[model samples]
Target: MLKKSGLSFLWLSAVAFVIDLASKYLVVKNFQLYESINLLPVFNLTYVRNYGAAFSFLAEHSGWQKFFFIGLALVISGVLIFWLAKNPINKKLQNTAYALVIGGALGNMVDRSYHGFVVDFLDFYWDIYHYPVFNFADVFICIGAGLLIWDSFKNKETSE
Candidate 1:
């Protein structure tokens, strides 16, 4: 079962990271704070900054959350790197999931470090309600989390 090493998939992580950063750069350059451009009835490119975790959790804190999140991402990133290095390459789903997560963590970490917040642009809304605006890093993280959940069910089935 142990064929190649999971590190072989690290490129996926890099790809995620680059895409997140590039998309962010484009948004930052082309939009101002609170700017919104409707691309569809339910979607828009809106520039915003997230000061806390998902849904701006603890976003009202007195700035301590920034450092807290950065430190947390660092710990998570280290743990992911260790896991990926030791994981067997045959576990494609697991490794790919981890890689995407690493990329997301790194992307947000850099944003928190350099800009004090995560850049958010994608926005979806109903006629009068809107979901939280998010970016590519969040996208990658969510996708990774979904894959992890799927892998867990799959592994459980195989084991039983």
Candidate 2:
């Protein structure tokens, strides 16, 4: 039987996965690669395929980066799942953090396995500066990471 925390984690992960996939589908079906539709002065819906990790790391490599990223994500996801399983029922925030990261990792893993790249659309920029284009998966992953950091601090304070 799934523990309360475990079930909650799974549910959050499922929701994140669905949203990520749906958004990616909408972007890919509507926009051509490298195309952009401006939504605000600093934001746009831009379709881009990243063959590497965050900030296009190792994108210049010939082809091995695909498998490397896939393997890395898979390992990280497995670890997240294990961590969530061990979490206590009352640790909602930590469970949520794990779930978000797991879901996001799986989402990008799907893209890397099928398309050899991850599809990114959300874009933010200033007049001459820009953030890396990313998708819902990346957003969730970042949020999860932030939560993890916050929880760590909270735990440390409580322990002292």
Candidate 3:
């Protein structure tokens, strides 16, 4: 049987997933494809779709990348769930990391299934340097990965 704290992680995942989906929905409803609405000197809301992995890797491939990413996200999400369920009680940082990753994966999975591409709108750039356009799901994943790394280091420190 799962512990009570385990459910909290799932709840966190649900919130992240909902927020990501809502953001994507608003972007799709309001912006045209490749439309840019300047939000600040270094930021903009530019709607675009990614049919590839991070930084648009393989985006130009002959359409096979879509299924590949979808499968990858699903498999990753499943592994996260398994890890979450098996986590030690009260392991807050580890749980949070899993929740964020699982939520992000499922959020993008929804996009991959419904639109055949991941919708991205948040854009940041300098005059001549532009970061890759990304969405909330990507944010969650990055943050989660960071936390996981932090957790590992903290655990190592405590054991040393």
What is the clash count of model 2? Answer: 0
Report the C-alpha lDDT of model 1 over 59-84, residue by residue, as the tens digit. 99999999999999899989988988
* Backbone clashes, each candidate: 0, 0, 0
Runs of candidate 3 exceeding 4 Å displacement: 1-7, 157-160
Better-scoring candidate (TM-score), 1 or 3: 1
Per-residue CA lDDT of candidate 3, range 1-160, in tens? 7465544688889999999999999999998999999989999999999998899999999988888888898999888888877886589999999999999999998998999899999899999798999999999999999999999989875544
Please give each candidate's TM-score: 0.94, 0.93, 0.93
lDDT of 2 by residue, 55-127 (tens): 9999999999999989988999999888877887788888989999988999998988988999999899999
Which parts of model 2 have CA positions greater than 4 angstroms off? 1-7, 157-160
Better of 1 and 2 by TM-score: 1
Please tell me which predicted candidate would have the highest TM-score against the true structure.
1
lDDT of each: 0.93, 0.90, 0.91
Model 1: colliding residue pairs? none
Candidate 1 TM-score versus the reference = 0.94
